[model samples]
Every structure is written in structure tokens, then in C-alpha cells.
Target chain A: MVDRPGGNPRAAVVGTGLIGGSVLLRLHRRGLDVTGWDPDTATRAEGRARGIPFPDELADAVRDRDVVFLCGPLSSLPETLLTVAKHTGPDCVLTDVGSTKGGIAGFAAAHGLSDRFVPGHPMAGAERAGLTAAVPDLFDGAAWVLCPAATGIERFRTLAALVIDVFGARVVPMAPDAHDAAAALASHIPHLLAGSLAGAVADADLRDAVLGLAAGSFRDGTRVAGTPAVRTADMLLNNRDQVLAQLGRVTGLLDRLAAALRAGDAVALVGHYQRARELRLALLDRELPPVVRDFPLGGDSDDELAYLLSLGAAGGHLTGCRVAAGTVTYTGHLSTAPA
Target chain B: MVDRPGGNPRAAVVGTGLIGGSVLLRLHRRGLDVTGWDPDTATRAEGRARGIPFPDELADAVRDRDVVFLCGPLSSLPETLLTVAKHTGPDCVLTDVGSTKGGIAGFAAAHGLSDRFVPGHPMAGAERAGLTAAVPDLFDGAAWVLCPAATGIERFRTLAALVIDVFGARVVPMAPDAHDAAAALASHIPHLLAGSLAGAVADADLRDAVLGLAAGSFRDGTRVAGTPAVRTADMLLNNRDQVLAQLGRVTGLLDRLAAALRAGDAVALVGHYQRARELRLALLDRELPPVVRDFPLGGDSDDELAYLLSLGAAGGHLTGCRVAAGTVTYTGHLSTAPA
Candidate 1:
């Protein structure tokens, strides 16, 4: 793998789902020789239809590939890694995009494949899933965590960095346990909270009223609850200890707020909220670059011009100007900085 | 008050904050004879600067108004409503925009003012607060809940409906107790959850790491945590019983999920998440109409025209046409519908 320093390396991705297919597409777009293998016929056909090269046999896809990516669901990662280990060439660098890193690292260590494996998790996903949900920019600007095992080879890092660069992701390295713990607090717990909040409404007799009255706060707070259940369960079980610990911390906070409410101790309740508000503000201060998207204008009438101006001023950073071919384009930042 | 059927009514808004100033601005936009009063000197100054008529004495603002809106914080609403009852004429309609309706209704009933009061909770807010944060379109397309007291007069309903219509809000009527309960699950509990999630990060030694990796899910999930602490505390304490009840339900769901994780029972965990996901999707499926806004273009250059087209094509329903003053304006819907 080290011999291909300035050249596009051969890559194979197992499981052509959202994460995997996205990696394949992004790598392909970046001019890599990529191949894919998935168990499902429909997924494989879909990948092929999207111009992704699919090898009929798993071993054929894995063999001689400089890098092998196990981008399957958490439940299937261990088996997929084993298949990669058995089929990949001696110099191949193994990586994965599973939500949890600890379990995958442990499996690789136990199988004596630790040196060749780099357990990575992309902190980016959509509520949608599968091949159709795959996008080339899915991992752009996302944090891509690489928890390299103690015995992992440097080549694995190099290969992983190259793939991450293709996806335009920022690489973050941490110990496997630390990665799991941080993820539990930042991602897993939020999902649990979203689901639990939604569940509370589901169990309420006034479900219709509650849903109707739900505003931006409720909608945003429960957005993750719409994610696929099996995927969430897989991540939760894979990172059980850390998820449980974070859940305990959150529950304790909830209890304190509840107590303050019961005692009519507005000062104490305000203190808790103030601290949380400060923390949220601090988190928001970490800024990212603006998101810009382009559009084409079709008409040149007064109504068309009014419509364009309306679109530009529609509660965001949209601005526009005319271009060639009677086209008008606009650039705007999509994300709103916290107030 | 009933003498003005289609005519603009005389209205007064107490507490010149975001909600209050917005009401004043929108009502003024609708050609109402509006006046405002606030205990805070700075807020009152800001409102006056925005062209809102203000009286130095609270009673003076309330005296001749056909409707008096107590738009203060939850803690201040009782006193404000008492002031309105003391000065307003017999036919005047009374209302308040407190998050929790039951407390306000109880206070009104105790003061023999229940018949004139229609407690409301607007399902709209911003992270920003105060007079500068007020916008004429703040309540547009938002749900304006009217938890009218049992003894509330018909005039109150009529006046509230007119105000709601002016704000372009959809009016939803419910019993005070029912409104409180529903709001606990839909709004208050969600805020508590957001705060708790942020609080968990605050307590962690890896706070920076967690925050850095916090993606769309965490950001959206914790957005309400950025809201002012005193306001949240007031709302929580005002609806203590319902808030506690909803918290209890959320905790129960969390406990079940934790138990399933501990047992490594994927089936049980999946069931909990599946039910939640279904509930969330159902809630989201209750669609609302799109929100449209307009922007005015400055120049007629090809580059400017291109910009307009690009703006129109950016991930929304954007369209534009030429208008007076060489303006090429565009119209775009602001919010995305559920996928």
C-alpha cells in the first residue's frame, strides 16, 4: 500500500448502504479505483446502476485491494472484518465506518488483525438510509474519528487519511474507549433523548394535541427519533457501558431540574438552565465555514424577478446575480449561528 | 369593544419584550390603535424608538384599550393581568402570552377577572429576546394556543381571534389544564431535555471534544438549551405538575432502553426505538403550509441575474420576476417539509 504514495490506490467497500455507498461514490469521484460488494442483490444492482464497480464475489472484491473498508451495520461489522482479513492481501489496510469503535477494535485485536485494522467512525448521517440515500458529499465537513489500535500499522493511518481527504472530512484520532465515551454523550444520548421524548408523546392520551402544538423546539429536539430503530439499537448495544453512563448523567440532571420545579425554587432552576445555556453557547461558538449552493434562473419577467428576490430574502443568507444563458445564481450560508 | 366589528381595535401590550413588541408591531401593521407599557426602561425606550406608542403609567396604557395583552414573563403575568383588570373598561378583553396557561387562568379566576381573560401560548419563539428581536412576522404560520378560561366572555374570544388573524397565526382552543399538560410534553419537557443534554456535556471532562463532535442531531436537540434561563425556570415552575409528569414518562422510557442495553437485548431496544420512530414520523406527517419570503435585487447586470437564478435554485421553492425600480425580486419558502 505504501508503494502507491502518489497514485490512486485500489479500494473495496463491503456493504453498499448509505455510509458505505457514500464512501465508494466519494472515493470514485476523487479518482480512485474502487470496487464494492454487498450481500443484497438490490443494493448491489443499485450501486452498479450508480456507476460503482461491483465484483460478484466477496473475495474477488477484497483480494489485492490496497484498502478494504468494512462499512456495514454494527451488527455485521465483525463478520465483515473477518471476511476482509481472510481475503485481503498482506499489505492491505483495513478500516470501517461503524458507529462504535471499541467493539470493532476489540474484535480485530482478538483476531490478531489489529495491526492491519483502523477502526473509524464518521460523525455524520442522515435519517434516510440505504443505497438511494448515498451522496458524494455526505461526509463533507464531518468529523471522521480514527481510533487506531495500539498495534495498528502506520500504513493504515496513511490509507485512512487519504480516504478521509477524498470525503473532505476532518480526521480526529483518539483511543477507542475515549471515542466511545465521547460519542455516547454527544450522539448516542441525544438519540435516546429524542426517542424518549417522542415515546412520551406516543404514550400520552393527548397525543394529537401535543403533536399539533409542537413547535420548532419540539421538532428539532425529536428529529433524531425518526432514524431507523434497528440502527440505533445496534449502536446503543455496541457502546452499552458508555451509553448507560451518559444516560445516568442526563437523568441526574433531569431529576435536579424536576426538584427545583417542585420546590418553586426559581433561583435554583434558573441556575441549572443558565449553566446549560452557557455551555450551549460555547459549543455554538465553534464556527464552521458557510454553506453555498447554486441555482439556475429560468425567466426574465417582473414576477420572476420578484420571486428571485423573495427567495433570496427568505430568512437566510441567500443573495443572487444574473449569469450567462439567462441563468441567475445565488450563494448563501445555510447554517444559522446560535443567537 | 364590540362596537368595532370590522374596525381596528384599541390594544395595549404589557412587558415590551420579544413577544410583546412583536405583537405591538404586527398589530400596528394591521392598522390597530396600539399602545405599550413595560417595567424595564430600556425595553420601553426601544419600543418607543420602534414607533410604538407608550404611556408612562401602566393604567394609562390599559384604560381605554379594547384589548390588553399581558405579554410579560410567566412570573410577571399575574400582576400585569391584575393591573389590566383594574384599569380596563367592562367590555375589554384580556389575554396573556405565558407558556403555561393553567397558572395564569387560576390567577385570573382568583381575581374575579377570569371572564375577561383568554390565556394564550404562542408556539413560536426565538433564541434572541427583547425589543430588537421583535419582528412583524414572528407569529406567522405559528400555532397561537387559546386556553380560554371556563367563564371567559365571548368578547375575549372575538378579540383574541382578531389578534391571531392579524399575526397570521393558526388559533387552537383548549382547556387550561389540557393546554398545560400538552405543553409539558410538547414544549417544556423538550426544553428540559435540551438543557439536560447540554448539562451532561458541561459535566464531562471531554466537554470540548464532545461539543466539537456534536453534529446536526446534537445541535438541533440542544437548541432550546440556549434560551434564557429565567424564562425557562418560570415556565417550568408555573407548570410544575405537568412538567414533572412528562419528565417521569421520559425517564421511564430511558430506563427501559437502558435495561435493554444492559441485557444486550437488541429486540427490546429495537422495539422501543421503533415505536418512537413511528410516533415521530406520524407527528411530522401532519404537514403545514410553506413559508414564503421575498428579497429585492439591486442591479440588472448579467452577473446579478445569474445570482438571482442561483438563489432560486438553491434547495427551496424559489422564483422571481422583474418589479418596479429595476428590482428583480425572488420568493422562496423558508422551511423544509418532512422527507
Candidate 2:
């Protein structure tokens, strides 16, 4: 293990399954002071077996920690985040690795912990579950989204620097609601479509006949449908509000295309397809924009938080941070003309 | 060129685009007498430049041919097939490489040419268009569906034999309607879903923000959305009847899942996803059944045609054919138990 420069935040992870275990591994490798605690005894034992400290009581683990990462399952996250938040030492910051942010973020706001709490989602995973699948490099070069609030700006900066410098991830700051909306657009809705496609093919008259006709389109479209039904169900239900809205938009498009095909209106059909083709091309040919900008840290103002949030909403990504020197650097994301 | 033995049907390809040119190359490589023709002068020139015999007139090119493949665009297939059928030598068989079978099959039934016209769709192609992308092995290991009518049984066997022996393709014999229905389920509807996925993501409020969240599911689901709008529109429109019916089924599934999510009906959601997952596993784990059955050729009876159609409907595949010795050998396709 290699020791890092000054001001390495002492960290505590409340869950030691995939994401949390991965955080523990990465932190330990950096020679930083990190502790892990899992509510499940078996999981806690597994973390201890890996030569990391795992205190029996969550309170004991989180005491004197500078930041506590709530990496529990979504079903258990509400209680878990609040419990950890309530127990953390004064001035300690809190963040999470949950998929949907609204639930836990709301709990934070309702309990008046917004100033010391930030919610995050790291876009990385292995196909397998639990600490067995965890690795130190899991977050390297991955996108770690942090929804920063004005009240939480200082802690947000501290947490953001830890994510970028220690975990080797780029942070994308979004408001909790916007993050859920974008997740719906990019991940959740496509999965629903995949399930629908797979189900339709399976329910066809003869499975063999359809399988014989299956090609790249069928394979690619249905690929995600095989994701664990439990996880998939949770993902959709957890963010149903945004998913429902996006689902409506997608079904509207499907209805229009179906109508055009039924009408045998070739002009309408081609024009409708043209729009999708143009967008696909624009996305494929887009290069990452290269304008890097810096925001002064420790400002502790609403403007600073809003600026960071706006940059992420505009798709800018945090490239690096110097917590000791107090600056966060980011670059604008896409360089494509809108379709 | 290696000469193929007995009854090598003298072949003429009437539209030297990718599929037609590929057929020409495959035939010529097998030392079959082949002539290529295209209405476009440049395409014809490209064909001749590739050392194919591109006779100036379509009638002259197809004269004395034992079989004529109408390989034109979907819009012109009807006229081109009829025109070639009008000029070909007596007893000449006709087939096509069009994606849709209904329009041309209906025209053949109307024109009293069903006895010799066998509509086919070869499941193969290059990404690029025209003779430039043509290759002798384009049909290698591909499924060539011959929608055999009882009246066209003899000609169907001959074409099936040619497809198997010369082009190295497996002939799947189907009734025209079944072929269209299978195509709709496997190809057409999946394409529409892909386009809808792509268009929805493109039309999201912030493209870069959405794109950032786009991962394997979005990419795979939208992979075929980039298929040229003209071709995709034509495919959906040509098979609109089956495509529309399948669309309703898919949208129905989507709506059910959406409602379940809306009502927090986890049971319905998980059960729905379970069905698709089971089907996917069945397909992936299925081993090809190895019972080869022999059908005596030259029967020319309705019994022979019905047997072939039933095999295809059950998804059995033609493994080999002996045109002169008079038999077709096929093996059952999927050993997968019903999902």
C-alpha cells in the first residue's frame, strides 16, 4: 500500500457489499485511515477477513470519521444513511453510493442534515455481486456523480476531492432530481424497453421460429433484459416518477411510428426514422469538449454550489481537485451539434 | 472455375446489387453459367468490371435461363419478377432476394405464375451497398427462406438445392405468411423499438447529460437505429400488417410494466421479468436437435409441400439436398423445452 499526500480524510463505510467493499479496498490501498461496518454480521466478518478493520457497532466505526459513505442496499438505505448521519462525529461529512438519490436526499433535507450531507452514484460495477466481486480499481476512470447543495458545498468539495484524487474518478455534480431524470433517460427506460422486447419474442407463437430469425438487432436490444429481475424491478420502482414520464415519451414515439407504418405513409415513415438516425449520428461523432474551468473551494456560498450544479446539468465533468489548495477543475463534456 | 455436376440450373441475376452480385459471384465460382443485369448503367458497369457477364438488356440477360432471381429493390420487385418471368425460357423457375415476400407473392398468385415463382429471402448482406461489397461467400452458412407454394413444389426443390449446394446456404421452406410473421417478430418490431430508444434519448432535454448516462443497454438497444431510414421504413411498411400486430403486443407489455411500477405491484413486475429471463436462458442453452429426416423429391404432391412448410414452421432446417438423386435432408432446429 502506498501512502498519499496530506489531508487524507479519515473514512468509514457503513456497508461492505460490492460498492462499499470496493471503497474500503481502494482507501486501504492508499494507506488512508478507513474503517468498515456492515449491519450483517457475515458481511462484517468477510471484511475483517480481508485484513481491514470492521467494528461491531456502526457508531464505533463511524466515530471520529471525517466522511461516512452509506453504501447499503436501496431498501435499507433510508434508515442506514440517517443512522450513520446521526452518529457521525461533529463536522464529519456524509455521502452515499445509492442508485436513486431522491429518497435518501429527501431524508437528509427533512432531518436538517443537508449542510453536511451529499448524495452520489458511482457509474461502475461488476457483473457479480458482493465483496467477492469488489476490486480496488473499480472506480478508476469512472463517472462519480455528486449532487451538491449550497449548504453542503464545503463538505461537497471535501468529498469530491476524495472521489477524484483518491478513487481516481471524475465527479459530475447534479441536483438530486435532475440526476434521477437523466438516469431515467439513459439507463432505466432502455432497460424497460429491453425487457419488453425479450418478453414479446418469448411470447411469440413458436420460440424456435423467432430464435432462428434473431440477429444482431434482436440480440443487442434484448441484452439487458437478462439483468437480475430483483435489481431491475427495484431500479424501475425506485424511480418510477421519472421513468413513467420518460416511458410516456417513448411510447408516444412508438405510437407515431406504428401509426405511420399502419397508414403506409412512406413519407411520414422515412421522416420519422430520419430524426432518430440524425441523433444517433450526432452522438456517435461527438468528441469531448476540452474547456477546463476552475471553481474556488471553501467559498461556502450558494453561488458556488449552483455554478457546480449548472456545469454538471450542462454535462461538464470534474477532471481534478486540489483540496489543500482549494480548487475544483472541470471540463465541458460534449462537442456535438444538437440533432 | 470448378464445375458443379448434374442439373446446375442456368442462373440469371436481374439486379447486380449486393445480394444479386453476391449470387453471381457464388454461381460463377461454382462454374455455373450466370449472367447479371442492372437497370442502373453504373451498377451494370461495376458488375462487368468485376468480370460478371452483364448483358445490356434484361430480356437478353435472362434468355434461356433455367432460373431467374429478381434481386431488385422492394419497390420494383413486382415488375421486375413479372418481366423476367415473361421472357425466361419455358420451365424456368423464378425466385427473389427481397426482404418482404407478401407483395411479390400476391402479384405472382394474381399473375398465374405461382407454379414457377418461388419467393425467397436470403438472410445475409454486407454493410455497404452494391457490387463493391459483394462477395462469393456472402450466403455462406446463412438461412435462405424459400416460401414454397404447392404449385411451385418442383421449382422450390430445385432452388433449395441450388441454394444449398452452390451458395452454401440452408434453405428454410415457409408459407409466405409465416415468413412475414416471423420477420415481423424478429426483425421489424425490434428495429422500431431501437429507433424509438434512440430518438427518445436524442430528444432528451440535455443530450450530453443523457449520453453520459448511456451505457451498454442504450448502445445495444439503439444499435440498429442507425440503419438507413429508407431501408428501415420500407421494411416496417412492407410488412406493416404483422409489424403492426406485433407492435400492439409489445406496447401492451410496456404498458403493463408501466402500470405495475405506477401501482408498486412488485409481484407483477418480477413475474413479467421472470418470463423473459427464462426464455433468454432457453435460447442460449438450446442445443441443435440432430434428427435428420429425408423427404423424397419429385413427389410434386401437396403432401410434400405441406411437410416442408410444417418443418419450417416448427423451425426445422434443411441440411442438404440431392436434386438428381431426389431427396432433402433436414434436422429439427431447437431442442429447447417451452419457456
Candidate 3:
């Protein structure tokens, strides 16, 4: 499968926004035959002006491409996936760069495209937006999640290897629902907290006073609150159940904290913060466990898939894959980085 | 009291922690006759090695100083204040560098020291701790909040001017209770959120998997979780009323957000995030309101004090002050930075 050089993907990105543009740029730089497309004319022209390879038609852009990325907005993803699927080769591996995985996973299952669909969510973002702000290194050292399906194992492995070798991203194999849940904590919660924290200060009796007093904490905490409203809303809405679940857990913690503070319960307050501090210290510790090589990519058994997903759950990441040898590599703690 | 040099007040820092050390360094660099004192023998030795002025006794360190800063831990502030006060000159302006203001403010009031006690909370911090990590620019462009008292007007102006002219800090004149509320939202909440979020992942089903997926949001949001548990607890307890109150407001916001996610309410979710986005944008915008000069520091009236607190509430900051001219200046919005 390492057929035409720079390793295995003849790819096409269907959206020219930040995520898609970034993927396109990274792949193109890696000497991959990567084509770009966007139905929006202005974006297409901008891509052209920026020297990104843009073929005239969507079908032509995707034709014969082994990897076809459907990078449309959440509202348009289902249709865009179906449309792009019509243009791609039968052996093509389909994927997306969305934050949420369940919606696309469901759409693929319903349409019987799970065999070809390898659901993905790149765990990366920047403060800026659009094609102009996209950079090739956006995915460098970032987690590019691949939610495996029952039959997409071969293509999934192929793409995961290329994602690792080409872009230097860590391939985290997860189940669709699992991806949603973890994302709710790692990615979505920041948006929720950002919105909530920023909202509280907006209603502050002294707005400038609060803002003036806002230092690195407030700035870093609310960084995501600046994300475009429509995009943030769609992400939260699509992963509603998981987001709601995680939000419930976090709010419970915050409630107990408030109670502790209200009662001036020294032990309770200290215990609450100390738990987090210790966990954080563990998470942040530099001395991680040894690398475990050759976590199998051979069989598509439920046991194998579960093991792979469990590795991700345990904070293990695929540093690289010995694809031809039918295995991947990981560097992880037995439990967490600190542990 | 520009008697010994730089700009004003022969200043002295009573404790040589991060805050005190930074103040000492900044003032010392500005050519002031500043001395440092630390009860801890090792810390005093460290200060000496670092070329920070460390007179042998606490009384000598503060002797005849026009301004004295009590920079001990929250637990030591009261006694430290009394001890330091005994050694200072009659006209000395006593202040502190604590995050929460109400405790010491109450102490000043109860002890009849309100006339000299100018409660201050410098809105600055560093990732590292102690004299080893101290830097002079820590408070540059940061808010040095001085919670106004009925009788501390003259000394308050004297110290506020030195805070501005010497260290380039903006003196935010707030009431003690108000300072606590703002600090709760700005400082304490970050610690709460960090610990809660970190705790959630530590107990994840596949700890490593959740840990693997954690990114910039997780890092920044949980940044404060790394703060020492004892200190975090003390700060929270010291500002219990305000921290609990702000925590209630924030948790209420989070609960509503979870409800929006649970209901899959598009408008509600979008509206929630959009409100934050709008406020964040407003807070982040570079174009600010006109400066209001001569906000009287001469008057200690109820109305003048209220007006000062209101200025902070509206997101207004003092760019500079004209101390001898009996006025401070401001750069603020009518309501919020966005407003």
C-alpha cells in the first residue's frame, strides 16, 4: 500500500476551512498527491491564491483518491459524506476532521458505509480561523483520533500509519461513543467552562475591574470562549449526551467546592483542591512509563479492538506503527502519565 | 515621602515570599531604600545570597520606613501586621500583598489600624515559587488593588502613587469585600476548576486514554490545580463569602449549560456560548474608553469610595495617577470593556 511515494495516501480534502486546510497543507508538504476542494467559491479562490492544489470539480478532486476527507460543517456533513462517497473509488477510505464522532458514525452505520468510513477527530485547534490562518504544523504532535468500525480496520490502520508518519500526529484508536465522552472532558468542557466563566464576569458589577484583574488564568481559561458561536453550538449539540454527562460530573465537583467554601470547611476545601493538585502533578510528571511495542493491528476481533481502545483510555498513544508488520507502538503509563 | 529616592515612600517588604521578593526587587531596582525580612532563616539567607537587602532584624528592616508591606502567608498576616506595625514609624502606611482583602481589612478596622492599614491584593503571580523565582517585572502593568478605608486616604494616596510611579502598577481602589468578590472570581475559581477537572480525569475508566486526549484546554484550565493545596485552601477560606458567592453564580451557569446540552436546545446552547463569546470579544478588543483623570484621592467620603469601586466594576483601570495634584486617572468602559 506504500504505492506511489511519500507513503500511502492519494488524498482530497473537501473543505478549505482551518481544519481541512491544515490537513491539506500538511499532506501536500509531505509530498502526498493531495487535492483540495470547497463548494464555496470565495474559499476555493482563496485556496488557489494561497497555492493549495484545487482541481475544478469535487468529483475530479476526489476521483481515484484512496483517502477522501469530508470536512464540511456539522449541518452539512451527512450530505457532504454521501456526495463525496459517490465520487470516490470503491476501495477508498472515508474520514472527517470533526470534533464529534457519534453523528458521523451513526450516519455511516445507517448508510452501510462503516466498511469504508473511518471516523476521525483531530484533537487540535488555534485561536484564529479560516484558510488564511491554517498552518501545516497544526497537527504536529497532536492527537488525531480514529474511531474504528467493525470493517474499516484495514483502511483505518493504513490511514493511522500515514497520519503518524506523514503529519507526526499520535493516532489514538477509540470507539465512536468513547471518543465523544473523552472529547467532552478534554475539549468540550473548556468551551463550557469558558462560556460559563466569561458569562459570570460579563455580569460583574465592575466589568472593567474584573477584566483588568484578569491575568493569565482568566485569559487561558476563556480562550475557547472566543470560538465562533455557530461552530461551538454545533459541537455541543451533536455530542449532547456525552457533553451533558461530563458537564454533570464537573458541576457536581464545583457544587461540593462551593459547599466547602460556604462552610469554611478547611479539611473539605483542602481535600478538594489537594485531590486535583495531586492528580495534576501526576498528569504533569515527566517520568512516564516505558514504551510498549507491537500492540497488534492484525485481527479485527472485538477483543483486539477493545484492547486498542483500552490503550487509548489508559493514556497510551501510538507513537508509530510497524504497519507492514501488523502492529503499532505506544508510550504510556500503566494508568496515567503520573501513575 | 519621596525622601530617600526613586519616586516616594521609603518602602520595606516584611516577608520575602514571591510577592514580597518581587516588590523588593522592583523597588530596589528603582533606587528605593527597600529592606526585606523573612521569619524563615533559610529564606533570609537565600535573599542575602540573591543580593536582596536583608537587615538582621524585622524592626531594622522596617525602621522609620514611610511604607511597610506585610507579605506573610494568610495565616500569619494578623500577627505579622502587629509585629511589623510596632517597628514602623508613626506616619507609616501599612499594606499587605494578599489575594483576598476582607480578613486583613477587618483586622485593621477592629484594631483601630484602619487609618494606616491600606489593604492591597496585587493581581499577579508566577508559575514557580519563592525567592529563587522572583522577578522585578511581575507587577508591571498589573493591578495593585488597594481596598479603601475611611481613614487611610492620605497614606493610601502616598502608597498608590509609589505603586504606580515605582513599579508601574495600576492602583485599583476597591472596598475590601468587593476586592474579595473579584479575586474569588478571577483567582480562586481557576484553582477550583483546575482541581475539579483534573480530578475527573484521574478517575476516568481508562485513565491513560483520558489523559492521552487532554490538550491545551485541559492544560490551561487545570493550570491552577498545580497550586499548593494548603495555599489554595487558605485563599478560598479567607475569601469564603465572596468565593462561595461567585462559585454559586458560576455553577449556576454551568448547570444551565448542562441543561441546554441535555435538552439539545439549539437556541439555548448557541445563546449561552454566544453570550460568552461576545463578552470575551468585548473584553479582548483593543479600543477602550476615554481616560477619566483626577478621580479624587483627596476625599475619603462614602461617595468617592463608591465611585472608585464603581470604576473598577465598569472595567476601568487607572493608566496613571497625579498624586500631588490630589487625583488619580482612569481608563475604563461605562459598563464593561465590551459595553
Top candidate (TM-score): 3
User: Each model's C-alpha lDDT?
Assistant: 0.74, 0.79, 0.77
TM-score of every model versus the real structure: 0.81, 0.83, 0.92
TM-score of chain A of each: 0.82, 0.87, 0.92
lDDT by residue for model 2 over B270-297, one digit each (tens)? 9988887776666556565656566676
Who is ahead in TM-score, 1 or 3?
3
> Tens digits of per-residue lDDT for model 3 on A177-274?
88888898988887888888988777767455677677777787788888888888898888888887777677778778777877878899888877
Error of 1 at A284 (Å): 0.4
TM-score of the second chain, each candidate in turn, equals 0.82, 0.89, 0.91
For every prediction, compared with the true complex, DockQ reads 0.28, 0.50, 0.66
Query: Model 2: how far is A238 from its true place, Å?
Result: 1.1
Q: What is the C-alpha RMSD of each candidate to the true structure, in Å?
A: 15.6, 4.5, 3.0
lDDT of 3 by residue, B1-339 (tens): 634445456778988778888888888888777878988889888888867678879988888788898988898999988888887766888999988888888887888888888899888886567777789999887878887655766666667777877888877778787777777777888778777887776666645666678777777778888777788888888888777777777778887887877887889988888888877787677454555655565444566566667766655555555544555554433432236
* Ten contiguous residues minimizing lDDT sum, candidate 3 chain A: A329-338
Worst 10 residues of 2 chain B by lDDT: B1-10
